[model samples]
Target: MMKFLSFLLLGFAFLLTGCSEDANVIEVEHPEKVTVAFFEALYNEKNIEKAASACSPALARIIRHYRSPQAVARHMFNMSYDKVEIKPDDSGVKVREQFKNKAIITVYFDGYYQENRIKDVKRLSLIQQDNKWFIDKILKDPF
Candidate 1:
């Protein structure tokens, strides 16, 4: 009788523990929207420092090596100097993705420059951290 009673108690304890577990409460965060927004802001002010703050925080190297906040801005500002010649056409970033502890973004701009037009061009990879994005490539061409 004692052996049977102990087995019953063990089963009851197991049941209780299983019932206490909260299995459907996992929370995941997506960082893509935040990154896209950062780029838009960068286009506006051309400030590398402000843009850096928008990245994932792991992009310190990228921000630090940009010559200076102003230099990076100059490039961005020049892209549209004559009338928004270079600008990103669109972005396809998604939500709730574990893409990488970091990420690489390929930027494509479309606009006009001195009667010259640019399209389907400009590629870059950005590393993300703590809500910041940093440039891994300033100018690169695969083709």
Candidate 2:
């Protein structure tokens, strides 16, 4: 009887341990981080897929026009940021005539393209679809 009880207790313990719930891990993406990641992927990593992941669908369409992914990424090598801001307006409801599914990110930076150093600001408009942000449009103010 003693041996039987020991086996039963061991089996019960194993069953209890196996019944634990799995850990739930959720990933949250911040707009500021996404902006930095976009540039990093474009320049440092030279990865078009990764960089394009940070853009909106409209931008993705444009990126496809390049001869290759590398060509698309090369456009960012001379870009450097000074400041960034994200404004999340009502992206779900019709209130005060705000956007329904978009966030505006303003990036102040220095553009050094073709040996021309220029202080400029680019506004990145992002859209949320299926819980992910994508670059939709880039509005640049020439310096």
Candidate 3:
């Protein structure tokens, strides 16, 4: 019985051990790839809510970011343009360091302008809070 208890405890510890790194050394499941694909699907469908849904909640207060999934949904449901699309450029994460229950993603992408086929690139910073990722802020770097 003692041996079994020890083994069980060991297993639990292993499962609990998710590594957390500072700044750039964090390990995560293909964050960049997932972000890219998610954006593609959301923009192509013009499903703004679904697009914002991929992001987290804590990032709402940041400038150049969405307040909530509902906010995005409302905007999409009530947009003057009615047609907005996002195309990703190259994406790299800034804060790979995993927190207790959050992560951050900074994505660089290009989007199609609604007035015409002209394209405009946008660099977006996102935060993952409560197991969800959301827009953190809009960045100004092209590269």
**TM-score winner:** 2
Assess every candidate by TM-score: 0.42, 0.51, 0.39
Ranking by TM-score: 2, 1, 3
lDDT of 1 at 15: 91
Q: Residue pairs in steric clash, candidate 3?
A: 55-133, 55-134, 56-133, 56-134
In the range 1-143, model 3's lDDT, one tens digit per residue, is 99999999998876666321121122234445446544553444544444444444443222115444334433532222224454444444344555533434444433343554433444555555545444545456454
Candidate 2 C-alpha lDDT tens digits along 1-143: 99999999999988877653211111235554566566555544555666666776667667656645456634632343223222332245432236556766665544454556656455566676776666777656434
Better of 2 and 3 by TM-score: 2
**Candidate 2 weakest lDDT stretch, 10 residues:** 19-28
Q: Model 1, 16-97: lDDT tens per residue?
A: 8876452211112333333444444455445455556554345544654665554554553234422333343246554225
- lDDT for model 1: 0.48
User: lDDT of candidate 2 vs native?
Assistant: 0.55
Comparing 1 with 3 on lDDT, the higher-scoring candidate is: 1
lDDT of 1 at 81: 24
Deviation of model 3 at 115, angstroms: 8.7
In candidate 1, position 33 carries an lDDT of 38
Note the Cα lDDT for every prediction shown. 0.48, 0.55, 0.44
On the 0 to 100 scale, the lDDT of residue 37 in model 3 is 45
